[model samples]
Target: MHELVSWGRVRLLGEAGVQAGNDATTPAVKITVLGSGYVGLVAAAGFADAGHQVQCIDIDVARVEKLRRGEVPFFEPGLREVMSRAIRGGRLTFGTEINAGHRASEVYFIAVGTPPLADGSADVSAVYAAAKTIREVAEAPAVVGIKSTVPVGTCDAVQAIVDEGARVPLRVASIPEFLKEGTALADFMKPDRIILGVADGEAERVLRDLYRPLQLSSERILVMDRCSSELSKYAANAMLASRISFMNELSRLCDAIGADIHAIRRAVGSDRRIGPQFLYAGPGFGGSCFPKDVSALAYQARQAGVPLEVVEAAGRANEAQRVYVRDRALSMLGGEVAGKVVAVWGVAFKAETDDVRETPALPLIRALVEKGAEVHIHDPEAADNFVRSYGLPVRCFENEYEAATGADLLVVMTEWRHLRNPDFPRLRTLMRTPNLFDARNIWTTFELGKSGFRYLGVGTRST
Candidate 1:
């Protein structure tokens, strides 16, 4: 974990009159972040580390108290250390409700969750609730920046809510968060670009000043209309998901032809137009962002009378890819998963985060269980979260080796670095049957066949 900002450095800067904008001339501003989830807590801590006073508010009182003591409920690397340092620096605080202190702040950021509804549209009730709270408590004019992932025109809707019999002028801006999980802190501290969707100049200036510390290296802030900014968040995630789905679709063809998708990826990704990122073939794309964003975008497109067929197809492919993997794993067990012990190596959507919102492992495990396979799941960081997400009857193991013990087949889902180089010989010895299913293609070069194990990799030829 690179130390983005330390307590001593921030305290000394505060003493020397240094502020958030990276310009000593500007004064420090007070910031209040709503909903101490991944995005909110990270933004609050990053702001406080930049010498600004931040108060993070969450409706969950127990969660707030846990954060106040520097305990992060979820797994995020380097966040607890920075959050603790910010709290000790007297610049970061947490509370259950928005009080007068937050009302007096210069900026209030709503980073609440916009969970997907049954129809795939984002349920913006939390966003509206946060706006209402800010409206009721705010005594002074403040820029109400929305860091939540909401549908387009959400900022306008929030502005209307704040404008309804308001005592203070609230400038609504759609500052949708672009922080990725597992590296959220670093992404916040050193962002690629800060998208500020503002209706007016005041909202723009307020957000720009708040993020100026991160922009010292380059002018990475992109200012646009609120509607465009709101759509940009969904568009970005959908584009990434499209790339992933496209690759997964091609991977199926590669497997059918006995051609390696790895080489195909290199051949195609080198085209400069098609980048290498998100090109890796895996079970499917999942997490809190990709699935929900894709679904919401498709939903919004339908509502607007301009259906996004490509985006919807990508989502379908993603769902099908999960089923394909599950079916492939069952086929490896002689067309019957009943009375089989199956071990899953990684459960998180990807690696490095405990978020299991739409992890492929869940559906695969569920299908295996339904087929009467005894499932054992293991993940370095996401075991607890997976267990919570999946209240189903399955064995949760502390280590990968333990999970693989006595298993008829082992499946790799997330590509954790630690899963890259496992003791193949030991794994072969531990399993009841030496069957290795490399879903992420992490062990393609391991030559498991030489170790007396049958290896099956996605889009790779088994030796």
Candidate 2:
């Protein structure tokens, strides 16, 4: 059996926000996922792992070929193993198009990317294209669940397109994804809550049956209107971003008053009202979700003439934090680091994933290069993606030891687990001058002063 026993009812109580219930498994159904990006691939693999026959379609021919060999293009923890198992068991497959063979699937999931446009609005052309293809090729009646992050009313708009085009009866639902990058597979396998935006009972029943395996232990699924479900995703991301910005702003005040943010965060977060999740005061929030969602939410509000002042302020604060981190690092080197060799540790936005969409490290690295500092960067998995995004001239190292060698300063951008406890003695001996900037505040307990190193931490200026 491909049953993943790791997700138990005990772990699902607070995290999944549901009480333990009786087991209710449904018959396995054929599923097709449009797009092979983060959301599509994870959803496909996760469904297949849950005993569903899943077919994932993508336009990228090369990417499909790679997956056929049980190789994942991006870095996500535990996804490759699950996907390989599903493929070897003949339950999961990939292709470049949705043809006659795929029409037998009862449910189709649209998990394509909705990239932001110049005005911060989500360019949903890819979503529309996927919908158009589904409308043209679906031979049998199917429920199309949109797992893409889209603006409000997107589901209704796509439904209208399918209504006018499709010959067979079709139902459309908005099922926005809440999977975090690093733990996307886990997030999908065991979600906090499954939001199903359906117009009628038929669509609801279809999705509920498809998700019976996940809901067996607890019924955490929530059924709501399409527009509300669409807005819920944006609101959740904005709220999380606001929390980070609020903490970051407080961290600045803490620095000015000679108070430690670490202490304040603990005291404040201990309250039941404000639990400690995204409350860490760091170099600000980054990755694929927060930045884009915040911008999109703010833009949507402004377009409607009811500006989201709180979200807008959060965006400004986040941008300011980025600038502050960059300037602080430069100041440590006597305010002019034109000829210094600075080593950057952890380039991915966060740990456990290789997604560097809007990572704060990009701005710092770009500024360093512009100021003539020789940048030596290293990440366990994201260096190649980073280099591909910004083709700036810099030294990319395979190992942290190589990157930190002969460096005047070392900046920790992402809080990778392995980066928390490093060979400080070796790093001290390798570099010309020992200056450590902990942007993620992962080393708050470390005593760098006694070890002959100048340590700088975000929101806590000691050791």
Candidate 3:
């Protein structure tokens, strides 16, 4: 562990800066990431960790104040340590204001969220909001890059917006960001490849230089037009979703055929092309990305007169998986939900972060209520946000024991750090019924069985 910290810290100094030959085609430059949410904060820290100056700008004064205090507002393993190191080293700086950050930066990356609307289309208002601010502020010569996941032709629309408002000719660039919440810092520090989209020269070179630290010996930079890069973000999520939905559908069959998802995944992923990531069967994939991106893509396609049938199906499957898990939890209690007190731990989707934008827990909680079950919930950091989103109906608990106390069953939705190795004995004592619903299957399923508890897991019976 010490060696890992040392090695990682060494890489933090740009020790392995032997960028691949392909990067020679484009030049390197400085970066400013707008909107210090999940993507911007992690990306800024990663760049700063690699010995680069990054200005992280956001409109939220409270969040900026918290970050200034060395307090990362949410849970992210190792993020605080890395951000602290970078901030102290004078490589990463934060501000609620945008002008000071944008003017000094040679390349601007927009990492704001493109939330889904009530009709399921992406609400690109935030994306446009940032673009408008950048156009009004950017000093001297600069390339305005879109790091937010946007619909096709959004780049063109933003380009016009900037051109109309700018004193100088600011070239609009699209360098879509692809990152998972849990592994965001690592992924940004050492990306699989860097994608840079530009209308003409200079922008590509600037982006390539900004990410030169991660291009070591891989030539992992793909340069494309602005529109293609914008769509690539959605395409990537669509494909990853298909993989999850595929496995989720197969998990149902595995039960019928008496075949196990674990064994089947091993056999399938052995192909090298299939790769082992995202193959694990679980409640479903939910977070700020997959659900919204696919829904936006489907909406984008429909509005463009092109139908994304596969993406639409994948969205439906994801919704079903969430409902399926809750239903299965109820089924474990013999399909009787009335007067049932069900304890649920981990409301934030797939932990290491406190983002509950589209967490499966929302619908699952609703379902529990509709079935007449009194749901008791607990999460590490998202409880407050969850309560604000939907309250009075759900009884939020302070601790896991309190959540499980007098409960007919315990459902583990998110795989939080503390929840991994819980006191099973004490938990059993607290619960009215010791039914363990392991949606994530973090612990040994057989151990759950031997614990003198009724264990219901997502996939096959664990040994």
In every candidate, how many clashes are there? 0, 0, 2
Model 3: what TM-score? 0.87
- Report the Cα lDDT for candidate 3: 0.78
Alpha-carbon local distance difference test for all models: 0.86, 0.86, 0.78
lDDT of 2 by residue, 80-159 (tens): 99999888767788999875656766788999988889999998899899999888887767788999999998998888
The ten-residue window of minimal lDDT in model 3 covers 1-10
Q: Tell me the lDDT of model 2 at 321.
A: 96
Instruction: Estimate TM-scores for all models.
Output: 0.95, 0.94, 0.87
Q: Kindly give the stretch of ten consecutive residues in candidate 1 with the minimal lDDT sum.
A: 1-10
| Cα shift from native, residue 100, model 3 (Å) | 4.4
